[model samples]
Target: MAKRPEVVPDILDWYAESARDLPWRAADRTPWGVLVSEFMLQQTPVSRVLRPWSAWLERWPAPAALAAEPAGEAIRAWGRLGYPRRALRLHAAAVAITERHGGEVPDDHEALLALPGVGAYTAAAVASFAFGRRHVVLDTNVRRVLGRVIGATAYPPNHQTATERDLAEQLVPADPARAARWAAASMELGAIVCTARNPACGRCPVADRCAWLAAGRPDNAPPRRGQSYAGTDRQCRGALLAVLRDADEPVVGERLDLAWPAAVQRERALAGLLADGLVVRVGERYALP
Candidate 1:
């Protein structure tokens, strides 16, 4: 196994050479930009987020800009980002930031955590990447990297745990700036090389030190079940949302019914959407809130 001191520097060197040129990682990117990217990235691929992120930054620019608009505008601008509810939450977060933080994305980790949709991962990412603060920053990528390199596991637990959080905190460097860099580097390495499936161990910078590789990379965990979208309520919801997003006014109940053929599933989907506050009833019609 590689020396503890060498792991972070090796990952940082690898990241310096191979990191993707995402806009949010640019030298000039703002705290607001990082916040927006974090929200857009939840469960969405980087490739799919690129255009929407660019357009969103161009249109909104800052928290105050998005705060000025109606929640529906944010939903409409979300385009086809899948989880449209995030758009609503992001808009609400912007309003909170504007009202409470003087329109600036707060630099404090706790303050960032208090934002509407901001969670532990987002808060740590924004604090480290945007403000150059020392933090654990354990996103899926970071967690996967740590799992193989340090924990000798094929995969991390299905959910984050107190033990995982403590380990991550210990792995973070003492120097604030370097810890921030390590956060980004480790995450980048996991995303591109130490991937969940078909990990490119040959290309990994810390392959020599990887405990999982040293142990012959055993597959102790069962295969994760792939989620199906077709004919599911999620698919039904997406279809119903697409129609409302495209319409300039509240859509009639019958118009929404045309989005899905199965009466039971359609009603269930609409009910779920309404329950989730993604859609609202407007007299006899429905609209995005």
Candidate 2:
């Protein structure tokens, strides 16, 4: 069995050579940049986030800048990111940062967690990656990597557990800098090599030390189900939002009616958008908010 400490150096060295040059990971990347990246990356792919992130940062470089904009502007700027509520929450977070944190993304994990959309994984990621603090930083990628390398599991649990948290804390290096690097490296390995499906074990740096590999990589019982997007209320909401996003003026109720054919579903979807604060009602029209 490979000792847990032995894994860090190999993973970090491989990361040094193979890590993707993501904009958020650049030396000059700001805490705000990291915060924005974290929010945008939620359930969205890196490839889709790149352009929108660039545009967003260019427009609102700081928390104060974004706070000055209306929530509608933030939603419009979100631009097909999906789950547009993240934009509203992010806008609220920026406003909170400007008012409470003096326009700075706080380095403290607790402070980061207090932000509107920031959660456990995001707070840890910002503290470790942006500030080089020692934190577990266990996102889906990191969880998957740790599950395979240490737990001998083909997949991590559907939700995080105390055991997983304790394991992550135990495995993370005590040295703050090394721990931060380990967080990024482990996540990168999972993202690019130890992927969810068809993992490239040959390219993994710690393949020899992986428990799952040693155990012959048995398939996960009760295979993970993929999310369905077609013809769902989510799709209806997206279509309605798309029309509003592209319009110059508040769209008529009749216009929104064209988005989804099923009257009940469309109404439910629109109501959901309104409830989510992603849309606003103006007289008989609706607009992004």
Candidate 3:
């Protein structure tokens, strides 16, 4: 196995040359841009986010800009990103940032967490990636990559554990700038090379030190389940929302009826959206909240 000290540097050096030219990671990117990217990226692919993210930043360059618009406008701009609730939450977060932090995205991690819809991961990510602060930004990619390199796991747990948190904290570099870079580097490595399936072991910088590789890349974990979207309530929800999202004004019941084929599933999905505050009743018409 490769020495622990060398593995970190190897990954870092590899990232220096290989990191994707994401807009959020650009030198000119603002804290607000990073925060917006974090919101748009939740469970969504980078490819799906790129255009929407650019449009969002263009329309609302800062927290104050988004906060100035109706919450529904955010939902309209969200496009087909799947989870429409995030649009409402992001609008709320923008209001909080404007009211609480004077239009600037908070630099302090705890301050970031205090924002509406801001969680531990989002807070740490904004702090580290935007402000260049030390933090364990352990998103799925970071967790997966480190699990293989350090813990020899074929896959990390479905949910992060206290043990994983402790291990990640210890793995973070002590220097603030380097730690921030490490956070982005590790996540990038996992995304491009050390993917969840079909990891390119030959291209991995730390392959020599990967405990999972040294152990012959055993699939010791139980078989993972894949999520089904077709014919699911989630698919119905997306369909119904698409009608409202595209309409110039609130849509009537008949409009939503054409969105989803099944009467029962359509009603159930629309009800769920209304309950989740992604949709609202405007008289008899339904519209984004």
Off by over 4 Å in 1: 1-5
In terms of lDDT, model 3 sits at 0.89
RMSD of 3: 1.8
Q: What overall lDDT goes with each candidate model?
A: 0.90, 0.91, 0.89
lDDT of 3 by residue, 52-95 (tens): 99999999998999999988899999998878888999999999
Candidate 3: regions farther than 4 A off = 1-5
Where does candidate 3 have its weakest 10-residue lDDT segment? 1-10
Measured with C-alpha atoms, the lDDT of residue 276 in candidate 2 is 90
Best by TM-score: 2
Give candidate 2 regions above 4 Å deviation: 1-3
Model 1, 1-289: lDDT tens digits are 2236568888889988999999999989999999999999998889999999999999999999999998989999999997998999999999999999999999999999999888999999999999999988999988888888887888887889887788778778999999998999988898889998999999999899989999999886753566887899999999999999999999998998788989999999999999988899999999988
Q: Which ten residues in a row are the worst by lDDT in model 1?
A: 1-10
lDDT at position 124, candidate 3: 97
**Per-residue alpha-carbon lDDT of candidate 2 for residues 90-180, written as tens digits (9 for 90 to 100):** 9999999999998989999999999999898999999998999999888899889888888788899888998888888888999999999
